[model samples]
Target: MKSSFTFVCCMILFSALIKSQTSLYMPLDIKKAYANGTRNYDGTPGKNYWQNSADYKISAQIFPKEKLLKGSETITYFNNSPDTLNYLVFRLYQNIYQFGAPREFGINKKDLHDGIKIHRIKLNEAEF
Candidate 1:
């Protein structure tokens, strides 16, 4: 009876460990938009306009590598919405981290604004 009880307890713990190992993933598509058969004056394919309608996905992962911290980021873009999207805006929140400092942030706010032109600005303080 004692051995049977121990076997059942071990089984329950093993099952819980397996259940906790599930993974999650998201799908995204990226595309470049340009006029068909368009050629540039310099004899190269015309540049694509990122401003046209588009979709995007951003992902990050953290893993330990040989006693060091390592991570990678991937950004996927797609064009599907009607409005032409010329640029992308990404707001990274490092302030939430305990080690984050204002000076440690590297993104250039000026360049971010230059990349995308906003047609309208709306604020909903209630949402905040």
Candidate 2:
């Protein structure tokens, strides 16, 4: 009788342990927790872009010719997400031509009466 009782207790304890290990806990104040850098979306707080580390950099250059404009931009995107992401989407901006000339206005392509031009699209080596 004692041996059977011990076996039942052991089974109960083992089941509780397994349940605790597999169960996921959801915090109540998830947003506040993230703002405090406790529950960061990237698994860690200091490694994300908000920490301002020297692991990556972004720069752009533009040159204008007599009738055309040329530009080149580079982005050093560091792997900061918890999951290893391969592909990334980047938005490219261009100046709209009005009356056969480049117009100086805010980034309102829809408001412009001219067409849109895509400069370049690049895929990083990490994407491969």
Residues 19-126 of candidate 2: C-alpha lDDT, one tens digit per residue: 785646657776666676655676665333242222334453544343444445466666544676665664434324343445555444434434345555556453
The numbered model that scores best in TM-score is: 2
Q: Tell me the spans in candidate 1 whose CA falls farther than 4 Å from its real position.
A: 1-68, 98-128
Best by lDDT: 2
Question: What digit string (tens of lDDT, one per residue) describes model 1 on residues 1-128?
Answer: 99999999999999999888575442222112123334443446554322333333435354434323334333345654447767567564443332323454465552222122224333233221
For all predictions, the C-alpha RMSD in Å is 22.0, 13.3
Candidate 1 lDDT at 92 equals 47
**Colliding pairs, model 1:** 30-77, 51-84, 51-85, 51-86, 52-84, 52-85, 53-84, 53-85, 55-78
* Candidate 1's TM-score: 0.24
Candidate 2 global CA lDDT score: 0.55
Clashing pairs in 2: none
